[model samples]
Target: MTSKRVLVAYGTEHAATAGIAEQIGVTLHEDGLDAVVLPAVVLPADDVDDVRSYDGVVLGGALYAGHWRRKAKRCAERNADHLKHRPVWLFSSGPVDSSAEQHDIPPVRAVAQQMESLAAREHVTFGGSITSHTPGLIAKALVRHGKGGDFRNPERIQTWAHHISAELAALN
Candidate 1:
């Protein structure tokens, strides 16, 4: 089988989002796709970069308050032209509690809306993992307000990755 390269770009806080991105990348690879995980902050500043080389792109961000992190939004905005022409998937990871339901899905944020205009397939909201070990005083405070614990589910992440792989394969 020919290798299909996928870019897993992320905007993260407290490293939780990064871990999720990495797991997605690994899952993609397991499903026979080549995936690279890059932080949104570390991506090249130029809007017109070489991201077109990838067959697909997955952009994930840590949601704070209601919107994605600023860096994540900037990444999408900067690369809007390229992303608009490609298969893109978006995810927002947050919500500290296990009881969260449909309300956990972020309201249509601007960045997500922009991608959606380009035919992005999905915008998933994954439960976040927060603990006392989360860094920074603000993180701690948020954890208290969020009643944080490990709410992330590995199976859900794996299923999402598999679905993405299946969709891409059908396109191919």
Candidate 2:
């Protein structure tokens, strides 16, 4: 059997989202799949290789003001045709607390809706992190409003990654 390759693409502002994408890629690799982690802004031109080159895709973005970063949105839109035919999963990282999990709702519905046409296997909302060193005035303001700190759960993230690996393995 041929090996499967998965693309773990993400958009991040402060780099936290990039870390998540990298971790997912590592998990996928350890599970016997080839995974590449790349920023949405540089997802390799569809004309060069196309999203069809990958067996599956994991797309994620950092949420701000109840919306995903534009680069992530654009990446999906640019590759919608080929992506629609592959196994896709979506994740959004946001929320100063674990409220997204408790409420069972995405931090940004519009962001989730963007994947409606792709028939994604799952859409997850993970807790986000903010630090005193967060960049930008708006981030500073949000931090001042008690939205700062590390709320992301590494164990939760790993569990989700394992789930993806298992699902892909089953498909293979």
Candidate 3:
């Protein structure tokens, strides 16, 4: 099988999002695609192929204080000219506690909407949250607000990755 290039880029404050992005890259590779993971912050300077050059691109960002890190959204938005012409997917590793957070999906809708307007092939939520051990400036503050739980589910992640792989295959 010939490999189709896929870029899985992400931004994270507590590293959770990066882990998920890496998992997706691995999943893609196992499915016979050439996948790479990169930090969204490093994109503007990296020699990596531009968004338009990939067979598919998946962008993920962690949600903090009701927002996906602005840098991730901006990275995707700034590449709209290229992204709009290629298969793209957007994910927000969001939801501290679906039962608690006022907004279930977080504010990634704005970024998702932009992708939709650009005709992204698909969009999904790989739901994530602050675990008890997650510690940092922002994560610490999140805990202060009563956010603590392992909301991540491996099954869900795998299913999403499978769907993305299928979508890209159909595109080709």
lDDT of 2 by residue, 1-172 (tens): 5667888888788877777777778777777777754323223222223578788888888888788877677778888889899999988887878785576664376566766877888888888888878788877887899868777777777888899988888895
Model 3 misplaced stretches (Cα beyond 4 Å): 37-49, 98-107, 141-146
Q: Which stretches of candidate 1 lie over 4 Å from their true place?
A: 37-49, 99-107, 142-146
- Report the Cα RMSD per candidate: 3.4, 3.3, 4.0
Model 2: residues with Cα > 4 Å off, grouped in runs: 37-49, 101-103
Candidate rank order under TM-score? 2, 1, 3
Clash count, one per candidate: 0, 0, 0
Decoy 2 TM-score against native = 0.86
In candidate 1, clashing pairs total 0
How accurate locally is residue 172 in candidate 1, as Cα lDDT from 0 to 100? Answer: 64
TM-score of 1: 0.85
Tens digits of per-residue lDDT, candidate 3, 1-172, equal 5668888888777777877777888787777777853323223212234576577788777777567776677777677788887887777776766542233442355766766766866666666768657877676777777766666667667777888898888875
Best candidate according to lDDT: 2
lDDT per model vs. reference: 0.75, 0.76, 0.69
Error of 3 at 107 (Å): 6.1
lDDT winner between 1 and 2, please give it. 2
